[model samples]
Target: MSISKNLPMLSILAFLGLWQGLAFYLHSPLLPSPETVARIFWQHCQSGELPYHLGMTLLRLIVSFAISMLLGCSIGIALGRNEKLNAFFDNWLVIFLNVPALVTIILCYVWFGLTESAAILAVILNKVPNVIVTLREGTRALDKDLLNMAKCYGFSHTKTLRHVILPQLHPFLMSATRSGLALIWKIILMVELLGRSNGMGYQLHLFFQWFDIASILAYTVAFVGVIQIFEFAVLKPLDNLALKWR
Candidate 1:
């Protein structure tokens, strides 16, 4: 309805135009035209191959995201509330945070013998630290006055959490969630690429081996479209609702 809404479409069109032009000029197998990619994408969809692989990757992403968010938020809140605990685990968090994701994926595959558990574990390990850092800062920034008020009112821990603590932490939780989705999905791709028998990443690997550029781009575009849909349909609405109290 507005220019802001139209801008995304316009930009996408301009990108396609540029890509089409470059692709035509290059006439290269490495950089197939968008139309070629789209055609392959459609064929994959019609054959159900795309959906199957995409679903596998999505499953891993969802599981890893859930575990990372739950564990990270709980641990972050505990550490933020206890100075001694925070001090002790601070370096541990730093160590994990600084660990390269590729190395983690490789180690998990080596140690766990390329099982699904190891793949998911690798993704969780890689993502949890990021969530911890985000939520720890949020916990530290919580309103002391509100917490004291809840205490004075004889509120139970659960009640206080639901009414006073959680409301304030919603923004940070959303931040972790959004970042988690992005980060976990990527890690899952690497996990899939390294260890798994099936998924978008595995399919991409096969495509790479055959130098199937159009197929590779098709898978990438499809996954990105799915991510975009999720952000718009789920995360954005949830963010707006959660922050409405402010």
Candidate 2:
């Protein structure tokens, strides 16, 4: 347990040490020392620049994620329950799932122009198919016996959904959300980089143009740290809640 607990810190220290050593060995201004990068990161934090960009990026993610979840789950439940509808849409869903995200994003940007709406839509397009596929499988696997039992007990559609279907779908919803969050955040960043005035991705693009490696690394670290916090605080709790019965 102690070894497991210490592993992350030890690995981080090792990485920092390696980075510092490489900077010293190379003796390049472009390759700043870890301390220098940390100092720069601190300055950005003090100025509140990092927090603003972080908040904006997170806002976009929340909007995109919420929209994707709503639409994806609706479509998934429909398709799962209706064979004809599923057969009709199966090919389209497969195509979207298999298409490259970059291509989709580029085409979306061209179609909608370089706007926030376009970027969010691009993220949705890239992420929704995944959620649909996952939830559809879950819906298809639901126990008909339990559903009939609910009907036998005179449960309404709402009641069945609330007490019967929802419980079975919870795990799949959690799985979809977990995977979607991991994927959509990165895609949103890519959308930001491709076109947008503000975001972590835009900042990273600006830093790259000037070859500011430290700032680039700082932005990346900041975003990754946020993702970790979300995983532990939000997704972990949801996963526990969903799997509690199991």
Query: CA lDDT of each candidate?
Result: 0.91, 0.91
**RMSD (CA, angstroms), candidate 2:** 2.3
lDDT, model 2: 0.91
User: What digit string (tens of lDDT, one per residue) describes model 2 on residues 1-246?
Assistant: 999999999999999899999999998978899888888899889999999988899999999999999999999988998999999999999999998989989998999999889999999999999999998999999999998899899999899988999889998998898889889988988998999888888888898999988888788788888888988998888888877877
The residue-by-residue lDDT of candidate 1 on 86-191, one tens digit each, is 9999999999999999999999989988998999899989998998898889989999999999999999999998998888898899889888888888788778
Top candidate when judged by lDDT against the true structure: 1
lDDT of 2 at 110: 99
Name every residue pair that clashes in candidate 2: none
CA lDDT for candidate 1: 0.91
Each model's number of backbone clashes? 0, 0
